[model samples]
Target: MIVVGIIGRPDSPWCHDATACLVVDGRVVVALEQERLSRRRFAPGEGPEETLRLLLAEQGLRPSDVDAIGYAWADATPEIARRVDSALPCGVLGTDRLTETVFPTLAAELRNKEIFFFDHHLCHAAQTYWFNPHRDADVLVADGTGGAGSTSLFRVRDGRFELLDRYSPLWSIGIFYEAAAFYAGLGWDAAGKLMGLSSYGRPSGRRFMTFDDGAGEFRLDPALRGLPSGGFTEERLAHEWTAIFEASAFPYAAGASNTFDYATFATDVQETVEDVGMALARRLRRRSGHDALLVAGGVALNAHLNRRLALESGYRRVSSTTAPHDGGAAIGAGLLAASVLGEPVRRRDPADPLPIFLGPAVGTAAIEAALDAESVPRQALEPEKLRAQVAEALDRGEIVAWFDGPIEVGPRALGARSLLSSPRSRTTLDRLNVIKGRAAWRPAALALTGAGFDAIDIEPAVAGLTEYMLCVHRVGERDWDRVATGVHVDGTTRAQHVADGSEFGALLGAVGRVSGLPGLINTSLNLRGRPMVLTPAHAVELFAEAPEVDLLVMPPYLVRRP
Candidate 1:
């Protein structure tokens, strides 16, 4: 069966992170986010039409070839539809337009193919659990509001999912963190930034949020839920959060000149999240009696919390998919559709890592065409020679834009489309943040081979989490000077473990030969506030725009700025 999964509603303010994926015979063929093609961050107020069409065309399959379609939202219910309508701004269509107009129009366009609507949190759970290697494990899904609630727990035994516990949106930990982000002068989407900033301050003794393990309750103020009011405006939430924080003796940091004042607040929020997450995982473990845990949803993206869960949650094993956020819901939707259609879900081998480079791969002809179109000075070198030259350039403190193979599907850059530089100096980190239009305090990730782990203090049980840079590890005191640039303010580094046989691994080996270090700082290759480069032309365009990037490497052809 060929199933197509989509996540988004056309022109819906509450809907974002539009994405689409294709699954053929229970295997993921391609997954793409609309933001990447639309060149808009999160692709707010957009639909998945373009992304769905691209996936069909890329696979050489026509509309008739698709067996069914899956939507990430359960729009058929009156409650969800009413919620969506209330969140829309003035002059927008009501919920009737969705079931009476939009979905029907979609079905007609696709030759009357059956469309399946799934619960939002179920999509997250299905997506993460289906792709994971664990067959019987406890699953946790936590995000902003979903159809039923914000947080959900499930137990999977031999491909069957049993709902264990769920929490209402009012008790959402995701919204609590989002409110903390807003109070710290960062936007709602700046949860990653808040996580990074938390490292700079020590946690206060007070806890803003707590969880009861026995009662399975997530405690927080309901006024700080930050849900959409009558319209798609944040003013109401802003006022409510401001009043609540002020009442608690924690004034808003709207105009604070020193960010340090909010640092403690950020740290407290981070700790609260960790504490609650651990509580949830432990409770789930006891309820389900499972040794392995699979985590999904937006909150699963927190590396520190993930690291702590892996170490202290008592789940012998913890794993998460590369795209655990809403963008990944598309993949989950596809998998769920395939399961409903009587297709057996393919189980991943326990020994191998999950395949993340699932996007389209650019060919040599396309790379050469892009280079010729730019008319830049270039040199064609053999694979070995290219690696050596790129290593030497990086050792000389120069940045290289590495574009090869398929693009990564998740938020991380990985090695497919990344800007790489030697992690030998703090100056390199500062320069990279400037080029990427990020704050100077943000830290970069280190990409290295299996041997690189010997230089750091990492637990063997949690090593799998480092493969996709999903968790952070403490930098050994002795090797602190070696990877100072990649280490964050808290002395932890988010490391990406590269396979020994991949092209990126060979390049790291060459760098190790040249500089005695097997790792380099790796970050996404994109213009500021834009999605990562998708095509060879996009890579070339970024090379032309970012003057600080010294070399552009697209295997077999290396281009240098004139």
Candidate 2:
């Protein structure tokens, strides 16, 4: 049976989601976010209408072919969550709302097909475990607000999940971090930037946050909760954090002093998250008696904490997918619907997980069409010659926009839709960030061949499982200069180990052969504040806009600025 899974639309322009997924025969055949097609950063109030239409048409099936529908969120969001002043229109839908707007005729035809509403945190857990290699493990999910609360812990034994404990939104460490992001003036999506900035400052003795080990809950200082109730908005969050900061001994700073202050705040928050998460993982590991751990949620996106947990959690194995955030919930929702319908879920081996090349594929014809439509000058070369040209361009310190195969599934580029550059240059990071219009502090990652891991200080177990750009590893002193451009201020780098024999791996190998560099500095192929480019048209348009970008590698065609 074919099951379609979807996430609720973003409430406003600055928010994210509106991801549509189609899981056919228990495998996610297609998943796309509305922002990619709409060209708006996390396009608000948009449903999956266009994404669903394209995915179905590609498979020669219509909406009527779907047997069931699954929603990533639970039946309803908490009423307090509705009080926030969302920056965009609120057309985000759940299963009930979906039945009204998506595919009128298909709704009538598939009247017997059941509509399933998976709990939000459960969806996060399912996404991690269903495709995870571990058969029995402890699953931990931490996010901002989901249904009744924030944090959830579950024990998965032989393909089933048993809830061990849960915490309400009041104890949400994720929300606390979001407030910290707002305090840094980086906004909501800047959690990553917060993590990077943390490297620049030492942990402070503010002691405003703590975790209760016995209770297994987060305890925030009462002063941090500036709002009367739990209602949170960007403005409110900023105000609340400001009050807390003002009360501190080293109050808010002005001008350049603000950067140091923000960095200190980021460092304290990072340390707090680490302290709480590690304690929780250790306790859960002992209680569940599981050797492996599967983690999800937006907070799971913290690669630094992930690397630390992999080493210290006491579990023999730890696993997390690249899309641990809400976008991945579509995968979980799809798998859950498949189980309810009795379809066989794909069981990958513990060591060999599923490949994440799940986005829409672009063909040679489509590339040519986009180039022709845009009136861009281009060169067409054979595969081997094109690889050689790209490698040579990288060696010369030119940033190349590389597009190939299906786009990656998660927030990371993962070599599918990535910007490739020489990692040896000290200034490459700054230049790339400028070209992408991102803050200088946001870190770009590296795509390394397997052999390159030997140069970095990564644990054997963690390095062996480094398919996605999820965990951070310290760059060895000897190899620091080689990948310096991609390494963050903390001497750590989030690297995606390219698998042998894949097209992307071949390109990385070629770059290594030419420049003797450990890996290529790889980042998402889009400007800052934009979702990864979807179609060749989007890539072509981006190419036209960024003159600093040297070349656009679209399979057989390569376009250089005229």
Tell me the lDDT of model 1 at 515: 92
TM-scores, each model vs. reference: 0.91, 0.90
User: Candidate 2, residues 101-207: lDDT per residue as tens digits?
Assistant: 44444455545445566678888888888767777889889887666667888888777777787877666667777767766767765778788888998776555
RMSD of each: 5.0, 5.2
lDDT, residue 381, candidate 2: 93
User: Residue pairs in steric clash, candidate 1?
Assistant: none
What residue pairs clash in candidate 2, if any at all?
A: 12-88
What TM-score number comes out for model 2?
A: 0.90
Q: Which ten residues in a row have the lowest lDDT in candidate 2?
A: 82-91
Off by over 4 Å in 1: 76-109, 221-239, 249-251, 351-353, 457-463
